[model samples]
Target: MTSKPAIGIFLSIALAASALWFWQTQTVRPAPAVSFKTIKGNSLELASLKGRPVIVSFWATDCPGCIEEIPHLISLHQQYKSSGLAIIAVSMYYDPPNHVLAIADSKQLPYEVALDPSGTLAQAFGNVQLTPTTFLIDKSGHIILQKVGVFELSDMQQRIEQL
Candidate 1:
């Protein structure tokens, strides 16, 4: 019973609504403001790295998956540092700071290594309850991706290249 003009108006409204919904859902969000102290007593702040892409990794010393990702992260850091990529590996609260420090030293980790003794960093990042959870924040501070486990090197590289 609707006239042609009325049908066109309805369709236009629906299309506009759909486009708004898509934009709201697809837009990346800014990373949470969190800070941590590196094992060597250096301060690292998420907000401070706004102009560079950052990879924030939550890990524990005893986690097998976490251990598995270290080399890949190190390699990624080495490969992307010149391209303005910063990686911060934050040890979980359950991990003793000394252990984290020793491992960082032994492995000669070139990137910043931090200790989350109170788990504040993890809690801020959506109560991250799993080891190996990683957030890839783009140069503008928006969270480009979040991975719950080991990050595939190739996939991560492709994502980074896009940023």
Candidate 2:
């Protein structure tokens, strides 16, 4: 049988290992390179936005959460454009181009809207499989935050303010 002190030390080591693993998973890394055409037929490359903070949001028209987040994104774009914040909304492969275009037009989205029909863009961004998966990239083109699902507007604002 193990002594009491030995058991306690083992447990502490295991706990420390688990915490290290979790922290590594949560830490943001470099944003992947991606090039795609926007709804307006303009060529947009991730590298082009290197000098500005960019929010690359993967969304689809049929996703309620994605739809709900658009207004907040638009507001962010308006408030931060002058400060060099660029927002790029990328529609998923399953979403039809026409549907994406229609929604973009209706919403009057004030940022670049692109379609990832081949799933290349999604794969580049860590195989993003869920709608509303968003990445906040810093001016140096490194990902600072990767959030799945709806993100709180106030929290996002605070993060941007720091960048």
Candidate 3:
């Protein structure tokens, strides 16, 4: 049988290994190199927004959660746009272009809205197939936070403020 001290040493090693793994997984990674074609026919590149905080949100018009988050995103944009925050709402390729345009128009969205017709953008961003997947990128173009669903508004605001 293993002695008590031996077991304790093993447990300590396991805990240290787990902590190291967590730290490596949580390390921030650089954002994907991608460009967006806005609904308004303007072209923008992610690299060009290097010196500002950016939110790249992948969403679909038919997604309930995506629709639910629009107001909050609009509020964030309005609150931070003047402070050098950039937000881009990217509609999934599966979403019809007409629907995307209608929603953007009806909501009077103040941020950039782009369409992913070929689905290349989704594939580039870590094969993002789920709706409402949001990435908060810091000024250096590193992805600081990635959320698969609706994010906590307070936490998001705090992170953005700190960036």
Looking at candidate 3, the ten consecutive residues that score lowest on lDDT are 18-27
Model 1 alpha-carbon drift over 4 Å, by segment:
1-27
How many clashing pairs per prediction, in order?
0, 0, 0
> Which residue ranges in model 2 land beyond 4 Å of their true spot?
1-25
lDDT of 3 by residue, 40-110 (tens): 99999999999999999999998999999998899899899999999999999989999999999999999
> Candidate 3: TM-score?
0.84
| TM-score (all chains, Cα) for each model | 0.82, 0.84, 0.84
**Deviation of model 2 at 97, angstroms:** 0.6
Candidate ranking under TM-score, highest first, comes to 2, 3, 1
Where does candidate 3 stray beyond 4 Å?
1-27
> Which pairs in model 2 have colliding backbones?
none
* Cα distance off (Å), candidate 2, residue 26: 3.8
